[model samples]
Target: MLRTSECNSEQNVNADGYRLITNENKPPDIKYSKENSWVAGVQMFVSFLLAGFGMVAASLLLDLVQHWDVFKQVSEVYILVPALLGLKGNLEMTLASRLSTNAHLGHLETSLGTLIIGNLCLIQCQAILVGFLAAMAAVAMGWIPYGEFDIHHALLLCASSVLTASFASLVLGLIMIGVIVISRKLYINPDNIATPIAASLGDLTTLALLSWIASLLYSSIGTSVILPSIIIIVGASLVPVCGYIAWKNKFTKQALDEGWVPVVSAMVISSAGGLILDYTVSKYKGVAVFQLVINGIGGNMVAVHASRLSTSLHTGQKENSVLGKTTKLLLLMVIPGQLIFLYTIGYLRAGHTSLTPVFILVYMSAALLQVFLLLSISHYMVLWMWKLGMDPDNSAIPYLTALGDLLGTAFLGAAFIVLDVIGDKDSDLGD
Candidate 1:
């Protein structure tokens, strides 16, 4: 039997050989070009811009729907829009990242049968749960009155969002895999290309899905609109049946044994922890619980990745175990710092209302800057490690994601603090 190390090494060799053979025969792809670096940067910048626009657009739409006589009866139902959009983007990003990782490992199959269906079911369940929580939070915050909102409307909106988002995720996953494959053919590192592209596409897809769902819900179209929704649900449900038939005919049950335990374990732990943290924060803090839950989960994921990296290194499989641990430790330290920063910003923003525009502009500017910095730094770090012979899938991608999340949160929090300080000084001078 092959040892784990031997198996890993063999995989790495195969991956490297594949890359070399493809590059030798193909022209460089778009992402491989130095010119495309600027293109990717521009795309990412536009994504950030669109994220802000999406939020504003959602807010305005909510206001409009709230005032409409036709929607007045269900106006409170509109509050779920922002939350659903947020979850749509987030879940799409998560699924995209996982698919990208699988593609990099050459584990991704083109057959859209079982894998696609499984993902759709999982994402739909997740999206529905998130939508419900968002609706509940909106009620708790008095953003929408509890008695004004129909639970059925909320459920319908949640179902729509999940179906649309899941379909968008599947399409985006397909596109991302193609892009990565082409990038590999051109001698470009797919890791550097996948996340940014997938994230941008995820944002765009989320916006489009939100708009489409809203149209379906509010348009003159009747219940016949439900046909599309039903089709998606039925299609997803059929995946397991088809997969079982395929397995029974061509493969043994033993084939499913590999990596099942670890994948299931990670899913269970992450999902449970996410639920508990979300519940705890929501009960105590209300809608603002999103930031804290995101921070905590992101931080813990970094800790877990650090632990895994350390184990891998000690077993003589890698050289940069300490690097992973060190990066994670630094990010862990920054968590408290981030919380303090967020609190300080909230206090200042509340106290200095006159400087609100300045505060908002500065805060947004800082967030953009932080995103750019985080992307650049983390990208290069992973590339450097890869050059030093680390496996991109096992060692680089997880750490990079964790680091990006940690730094992104920290920088966003810090930006708010800086803006607050500036606002405070301006207020003091006016006094």
Candidate 2:
């Protein structure tokens, strides 16, 4: 009886030991249950699908909006559509990225009324300036007759559109941040999801706002005193509101403390350059001054290099070779794209309407080229940084985008002049 009891006890001990080993080996599977895994897969799939659709839809909507009746009546509206939509996308992306970072750092607040209002005012200022310049450019190029659309009318319509779009973007940015936060809680990647979604939404919202503003302008004012009066009232109200915000936020002090001098100087220089270019193009007859302006502004690629040098100085990082390579790659890609865009604009203005097919081909080619170049440069830069024992994300890609815009515009202008002069010589000989 004693021997039989001992054998049973030994067998029970062996069984218990096997159970422990099995649990330990199956930990990974246990940690990821079938339900949890399925949910994660579904979420990721949905996010990616939405992102793809959003990009495609936004592109189509922008094309449709450009051809809408109001814009068709004023052909310069074509240029305005791209400029405004690009600005909207860029701003929304910036704001969304900032908010996402803040959310990650636990610094974002739900109360965005003040922020939204402030952004709206800034956007209005930008839109008015851009609209005036665009209209003036069209007039100078003879794309639109000068007296047909006054600067004031353009400014008012633009301001209304900009204000509406900017407010909508702020709300969208907030929503994107919230989505990002939720995704993070679910252990999903937010960076891959937030920016693209925000940009797509911004594009659609901008088109809608522009359409609504056009409707309002046509129905309510139709080129009259009421329109001007509304613009004045809104502009006046914005001044005080901006002033109040500046005071409440202590923006002056903040700016000074945070190295605002360089930034402000850059902005002032850029704006002044733009205005001078506008004036020169409008007043002069010898050359395409708009192209000159774009080149002058775009060629100031010094900002990115300066930022890089500053980073290197502060961090004692030695990556000059990598930086040079990346910058060269970007310039190669961006310069050609700008040139093609400028060429299309010049040809279109010169009454080469059939060149539209060529323009489309060039645009698509440049876009694809830019994508590949950007990806290559970004990958190499990141890889080089990783090799050097540093976080690539901490580098200045964000600043690069703005710097690229400036340079791209300048390059486009230069290309336009070259192409236009060649075309003119051919025409003169034929005549």
Candidate 3:
């Protein structure tokens, strides 16, 4: 077992008894050195810029939606979209955050042990479990009124979600770990660069994989049923086995114990967001493009905060306070992002909708509210997890971004109501 349960700031001494240490415990001096504020701001600016493009790239899902034949055939795919995206973002974001924290603690280099293997196993297991549940949800919900309760579709949804999630978890998870490790070696704050890159890349890769799998299923229903059946059996079988390993290991146990709250909550909330998108996506030409971007940017901003707060709590620098210098700087970073994306991308692509002040106000208000709520929740979640001897990095980003998806969707729907943006309820869902 790794000696990671130690919490005392004073006891963080080196092996030589000379107080020498690594970068994990010693965060960069940005919080203390006022001179570093400009550098911090510049780094965050670039990070969010990448995040904006990354999220916008994910809008290619809208392209899939435009294919009327495929879309009408696979209506449940709409429901699967947010859940799949949320699953990818949640799993990868958590991985990036945890790796950053581990790098900070110098425990990252100890890679050949049970903890590492357990984490990899846990990621795959959770992806499969969550994917299965999400597909079941889509099937169950579709049956209620839509009444498209074909077992074939359910199997496709289940198999596709599980396969995409597992594959992405393994591929993107390794890519992110490598990125975090390299960035840290180069003196870049993995906290700053890691989360956005992981999240954006996660969005891109997950959607691409999902599209491929769904297209394959559409190509041949027989092949789809056979392949997914095998995948579901294998994936379902491994869940318990992986759960047992995570339960036994010291490092992964804390994660396993606490992972469900964020994952389930995010899924439930993202379902709500999905419903809103389903209702309005047809009427609002560019809403599909902007929804993920807004949520992505909002989530990315919160991830940076969550990663920083985790480091502070672990290193005993900032306690649980959310209004520190770093928080303020991060909060400031969201303003221009909201304006730039909402005006340039969201507005322009919104089918020549007038850039009225009311539109801007409603959108900005919703985006900022989402950011603020995520930050507050992240701060408290980190504090609460820390109090219980758990690592917040394991769950914080996942929780925040999932909630961001929920709230961002809610806020957007509310804006639609206030401004009457969604026209003719029946027409909104036009075939």
Best by lDDT: 3
Give the poorly placed runs of model 3, Cα more than 4 Å off.
1-35, 63-68, 112-116, 222-224, 238-250, 343-358, 421-431
319-345: candidate 3 lDDT, tens digit per residue = 336676667777887778777765655
**lDDT of the structure predicted as candidate 3:** 0.70
The CA lDDT of each predicted structure is 0.39, 0.39, 0.70
lDDT of 1 by residue, 200-253 (tens): 354445545655564566453344446445644664564455445424421112
Off by over 4 Å in 1: 1-151, 220-361, 364-431
Model 2 TM-score?
A: 0.49
TM-score per candidate, chains pooled? 0.45, 0.49, 0.84
Better of 1 and 3 by lDDT: 3
lDDT of 2: 0.39
Q: Pick the candidate with the highest TM-score.
A: 3
lDDT string, candidate 2, 271-389, tens digits: 33333333333332222312321321122222222223222322223333543542453344344434544454344343222233443344334333434444445445544543443
**RMSD of candidate 1 to the true fold?**
10.9
